[model samples]
Target: MFYLPALLISGVPLKEKIVLRKLTTLTMLLWLPLTAQAFCGFYVAKADTSLYNQASQVVIVRKEDKTVLSLMNDYQGDLKDFALVIPVPQVLQQGQIHIGDAKLFEHLDNFSAPRLVEYHDQDPCQPMVAYAMAPGSDAMTKYKSDRIADRKGLGVTVEAEYTVGEYDIVILSAKESDGLETWLTSNGYKIPPGASVALEPYIKQGLKFFVAKVNLAEQSKTQLKFLRPLQFAFESPKFMLPIRLGMINAKGPQELIVYALTEKGRVEANNYQTIKLPSNLDIPVFVKNEFSDFYKAMFDVQVNKHKLSAVFTEYFWNMGWCDPCAAEPLAPAELKQLGVFWLSPEQFSGAGLPVQITRMHLRYTADSFPEDLMFQETGDTQNFQGRYVLRHPWQGKPEQCEAAQTYFKQLHERHVQEAKTLAELTGWDLANIRQKMDLKDQSSTQTQDKQWWKSLW
Candidate 1:
């Protein structure tokens, strides 16, 4: 249960037709263009965060040191026991905190999730070719108590506190990690073991802690069944997320999907290796129905292959529109609600929002990620997604024309090739894929056209 994970992300995209090419690489993962100016296909399906069991979602809207961050999670337990502590660069004032809508997170995830696209091969004799592209709330509490001295006068200052929505927010600054740990524990917040050790470096760096617990009365007043997301706006030079604290309480590796909204271009991890997930592989059409299972299996395989140390960029695109949107792009109004401070009313109506979106996914345990996640917005704005391809072979029969006969000969070869690629991508048994593809009885020479004469037109 990695329910204790911390994460952040948010972005926007609009569809624009651009040129594309058939990705022929064996197992290499690459981003697929959403709409092709020259060679694009209809975007069909997408792999969203719902595929993962214990994933956390975050949205980050940033311009320079200034950032608006929203945090959402599915805390199915008692709201009374839910508490969150995150390290920030500075103390947040009353105006900086907000409560956000959860639908904003869903919209971003749909727009940025890795997708599936299909292209039926045109008649082999066709003049040109085409390609395709694919793409929580908590209660509130009230704050009343004043600053109180702790054991040994350990310097833990309650810098600020506020009742925001259903949360009772407290900002703290501490001089020593042990004192901070003791103070939090004494106050009835369950400080996870080894948290003091993780808090040391942040305290030394002069960071402030933003703590929140549920306020039953405020929550009941909201009249919502679940917790809404918490948003905070701040300006700081550090572009990073505090994850070390999450490791203290998680039972296993935590999963995260980040939707980063930047004014200029894509965002990536600056401190860790940022790798793109394996994408744009040609697989059998059977995958369309089982995309979720396939994606999880493929992701698990890649995580093990990478030893779980790297972060992955799943999608990065400009947020004006989508070619064949898996879900509609978030409206400018929704973007503003998610804390896109720079977005203005004019931009929302005209050419859509100018903001770009970057979707990053990562999984880590305490052992794999020892430090917090650090990120930097990149100048690269090239479109990319964790996209899978399913080429529905042209169904023209051998009697159609000479091209049809030729196509059938090559189609078998392509089918065999597709099978092999699927096996490699998912590490599935070749025999099983062949069985599923109905290629179990075909011989090498026969498949290689030893019987080419049988199909001669």
Candidate 2:
């Protein structure tokens, strides 16, 4: 049998009896399931009654409507338990019950990162238009509007058109004279003093022009060009130059529009050169992953009309530990083992057909971690310069020469002295170190040495 605690209702007023009765009913309703379970041989086990047995099943019903409220114990069995029927106000159904702590929501909001939205359009040939404030021109103000009576009658709009070629060219035209002449003189388009006035008609009509020409064939077209230095042999019967194209637009699958500017950096497209490449030839090409999407968008543009073949060639260089005391300079044993470097299209090669590399610059850095004395001594020699001299194949003694032989002799002496110092510090035999360093140095030198062009004919 279960015992019920005595009620502490002393000194209660008679008028409050109805409220007391309702509380008594609710208490009885909450205990009904435990009472029935006790009678059914289910034990009411508890270390502390303050801990509610949440695992137990509970059912709530409306008492005024004669509905049943059945609460179950943790161990439900074949034996039937008594049902608790209690009266509850209809308003209790409208309230909500919340569980758990409120801080969980704040943690979730803090973990999210900013998101980026990318915008791209299928048409590649979209023109870029911009209006910039003229450098020395004052802002137009209503106060000064009457300075020139022509201001009321003058209406001006400047139009700039560009096209592609050896250089970019631009033509600027406007209907107003003040702005046109101001723009031309400020941009270095002023006519020479005492020169013939044949250009007067064009200038008076508010026209300005600029031109920029560049070699196109020497530009890198693919990823392979970035991996290493490229050697270009222009065997074309006609002088065809390679040009590096910037900001090209694929207006349509067949139409590619590139902004052509003149040498004076003006937009002009009056003349265009179109050449078509041989469809039968397949040339390997490479481009960085970052530019993959850009190239894909431009692949359909007609290449044959440009009369140019764009091929991607793999180029690479390597540097490793070198011992100045040893006979040879140190480099990667194989191209694959070396630290591979990549360059952008502009950095990879020159642009233009029959590309001529007028200037070549190379820098090498070496590091030796204590083990090799020769390598350690040479680490401070940061810059070693060399250049290629191009001459006709049959020229007995090429007229063109880079750094004289005296420069090479000086470089050789520096290497030898550095190697000797390293040998003394590392406790390596001078003879052995010299032999090894010499072989390595010779191999490296041979690989990079440039000589006059020799014809195979």
Candidate 3:
């Protein structure tokens, strides 16, 4: 299935959606690397960014004021219809812009996605010795003389332009949002209604515009099935993402996942509350089959509970290793392609090279999120991930031995509690969860068996 890139700004033809289709969640069959065995549980499945529709993904590699921002656009339509208008702190030079590999994003997504891990039950009669597992770890475009004069009159300046990879990029500094909107509409970029309001804030902040459109001829040469990600590097004090522009033309609340790589520690939203998703919970084994559904439902519940105002920390850990890696740790070369400027090739293999990655997910509407995302890097290096657990019950019968009997009895209680936990997390009906587990609904059984006249005085 075709998946949409989430990193787009002012994408047009306004109706051409950057949509994501549902992917079959890979379950127990996924091979966990040998290194992952260091963790107490075995890696089973994951809920990656692909599970959501209409989602965007951004990678921010920042150290001090130096920053490299990469956007993956998931546009599904005619190549000619694709265009983007993003606000930048300054005009980017030709050397500063680049087209990046989509694989980088895929590797990062798999590495940091919320994961599902499992542990098998040891025989009740045998000593549990396996429990002691070790821990693992844009350039401006050139314009004609009359074009320059026309742009000047409209309070707009085409600072620079470049044809990088398959994109035709233009850098613009606008004096007013209205004039900028006019310039865009006049230049064949279909400006959605109410775009002026969205453009106003960036203009007021003295930010420049990085505009891009598909060069169909160049794109055809690549013979690629999807657009390659666009990347640019610059120095700026502002550590934020301009999402307001993307929302102006959106039909509904948009999903965004930001992967931030920093030297000191994890990154978080400065203006909004950065909450962590519920993780490390023991769930029913049946969830192994429907882990995708379980995650979506749980995410929906979290969004509602927070009123869609919170940014959720899905994963945060040092890049050197993962306790129960969803995928292998990224290689040093991959890190360089991702714009990790501070790390040298020699330092990539060293554990001392500080690279902390933070994965943040958000589901937001214009009403719930009134401002673009602003971020701050913190020194907190605590390792966290949105991980769920499933423990396979022992197959031995209750009558096999004394320990077996005890195990089955305790297992029943555990199953009941697991069902309750699932219900609470996903808002699924408790009775239905119990039925799916093939366990009796004790509540209903007690109700039906109780004497109706027990309350008689």
Winning candidate number (TM-score): 3
The lowest-lDDT stretch of 10 consecutive residues in candidate 1 is 36-45
The TM-score, computed over Cα atoms with residue i paired to residue i, of candidate 1 is 0.81
Residue by residue across 348-438, what tens digits does model 1's lDDT show?
Answer: 5323457888888787777888778889998997777777767777766877787777787778878888888888878889899889888
TM-score of each: 0.81, 0.13, 0.82
Candidate 3, residues 120-172, lDDT tens digits: the string is 67678863424322222101111100012234578988999789998888899
Q: Number of clashing residue pairs in every model?
A: 35, 67, 9
Question: Across residues 156-247, which tens digit of lDDT does each residue of candidate 2 receive?
Answer: 22232222211122333344445443443343433222212322333453333222211133212321111111111111122111111100
The lDDT of model 3 is 0.73
Question: Who is ahead in lDDT, 1 or 2?
Answer: 1
lDDT for model 2? 0.20
Error of 2 at 338 (Å): 52
**What C-alpha lDDT, on a 0 to 100 scale, does residue 300 get in candidate 1?**
75
